[model samples]
Target: MDMRKMFGFLFGLMVSLWLGVSLALAQSGYPQPTATTLNDFAHLLNANDAAAITQLLTDLKNEHGIEGTVVILNSIHDYPTGDDTIEAFATHLFNTWGIGDKADHKGVLILLAAQDRKVRIELGTGYENQYNDEMQQIINEHMLPAFKQGDYGRGLYQGTRGVIATLTGIWPPDERPVQSGGGSNSPTPVTTASSSRERSDGRMGILIFGAFVVIVGYLILAHIFGWPVGNSRSDDDDDYHSWSSHSSSSRSSSSSSSSGSSFGGGRSSGGGASGSW
Candidate 1:
C-alpha cells in the first residue's frame, strides 16, 4: 500500500477506536438518583423491605429533619466518575445529590457496592468527626455479617436503622427485625466523645512510639554502614444480586416512589467509614 493511504487508514482506525471508547465511558457513568431515600439500582431489596425502609426514612425526616439516602450498586468502578473506594464514591454521590438540608447539613448516605464487597456510611459536614468510628462499628457489626451471609436486604435495612438510631434515639419499628443475626452480633452503642478521644490518643501514642523505634533502628544501621543518612523520605497516603427475584415496577412502586424530593441540597466533606465483607 502507498504510504499516504496507510497513514490515512491508521488515522481512521484510531479515531474510530477513540470514539467507541468515549461512547462506552459516557454510557457507564454513575446513574443519577431517582429517589430521595433509596436508589436501589442493583435491585437487591424486596418490595416489603423497600417500603419499610422508605417509611422509616420519611418518618426520620419528619421528626428529626435528617435526610438519609441508601444506594446499592453492582460495582463502584462500573461507571465513569465512580470511585473504586467506597468512601470517595459515597462522598461524591452524597454531595452530587445534595443529600441533606443545605443549612443544617444533617445527611447520611448508606452505600453498598455488591461487586466490590464494600460499603460506606457517609455523613454530612454537620456531624462531628468522631462519628466516623460509630459508622465503622456499624459496618463491622451490623452490615458485614448479613452481607457475608448473602442477605443484602437484611444487611442494608439493619445498617440503615443503625445509622438512624445513632443520629436520633429512635430505632426501627419493633415489628421489623432490628438486626440480622444473633450470637454476639448485636450492634454496639455509639461511642461517646470522651471515649473516642481516648482511643485517638492511644493511637497517636502508639504511632509516635513506632516512629521513634524506626528512627533508632535506621540510625544504628547507618552508623554501622558508614553511610551518610542525610536523605529524608516522606510518605504521604451495591447490591444487584437479588434483582431477578422480583420485577422493577414492584420496587419502584414501593419505596422508590416514596422519595419525592430525595435530597435537600446538603453536602458531605468525606466524613464516613468504609468496610469490606
Candidate 2:
C-alpha cells in the first residue's frame, strides 16, 4: 500500500513537468530575426529625433509591407504621465495611432519623446495573448538597446517582429490581408478569442485534476487508518451458533430421577421372621 502511493505521486509530478515545458515552447522561444539588425531597423525609419516616429511607421508599411496600426494618446483626465504610466500611454496610443490612414495598416509607436510617459505596444486583439512578456522584453531590452544610441524604429522592429512571428505561425503570412486587398474595409474590432478559450480550459483542467488527486489521497489515508464506511455488526451475526437446550429436555430428566428415588427401598420382613422362629 505504501509503495502504491509513492508511485502515484511520481506520476503526477512527471505529467506536471511535461505540461510546463509544452506551454513554454508553444508561446515563447520564437527565433530572433537576423535579416534586419535593430540598428538598421532604426535607420530605416530614422526615428531618433522627434520626427523619426512618423517615418518609422511609414517605412514599416511601405518597405516591409506590414499590416497593423499604431496607437498613441496625448492625455486623459489630467492623468500624470510618468515612468509608472504604462497603461495611460497604451490607451492613448490605441486611440490615436490605432485607427489611422498614415500607414495603411498598423503603426508601431516611435515614442519620440515620452520620458515622463509610460510606453506600451498592444498587438490588436489578435496578438494580445500571443505577444507575451518574452516578446515584450525583446522590444524593451534590445529594440531600444540604448536610449542614447537607439532609435525608435529599432524598438518598432523588435516589438513588431514578435507580432509578425506569431501571426505567421498561426494566421496567414506573406500576405497582409488586414492591411490591404479589402481586408482593411471592416471597422468591427477583433477580440482575443483563442487565448480566452485556452485560459478557461486550463483553469478547468487544474480544478478537475486537483479534485481527483485530493479524493484519491483521502481514500488512501483512510485505508491505512482502517476506517469503515458502514456497520460491521451484520457480519458478526452471520457466524453465530443456535442454543438448542430447550425446557423439553429438562422435563424428561426430572421424571427419571424422581422414579429412582421412590423405588430405592430395603426389605425388612425377612429379618423379623428369623427372630420369631
lDDT at residue 9 of model 2 (Cα atoms):
62
Candidate 1 C-alpha lDDT tens digits along 1-277: 4785666556655655664564443233455566778877666666767877787777888899998988877676655574757777888778777889999888998988776788989999999475899899999998898888777767787898899998997777734544345421222211244334434544564565456445444443333333345543232110122222233444465455546745788989999899996
lDDT of 2 by residue, 131-225 (tens): 44644564556444422342333344444444444434432222221222322112222223533443454456456545644544444343334
Give Cα distance to truth, residue 7, candidate 1, Å: 47
Whole-model lDDT per candidate: 0.70, 0.35
lDDT of 1 at 197: 45
TM match of model 1 to true structure: 0.60
Specify the highest-lDDT model's number.
Answer: 1
Candidate 1, poorest ten consecutive residues by summed lDDT: 235-244
lDDT of 1: 0.70
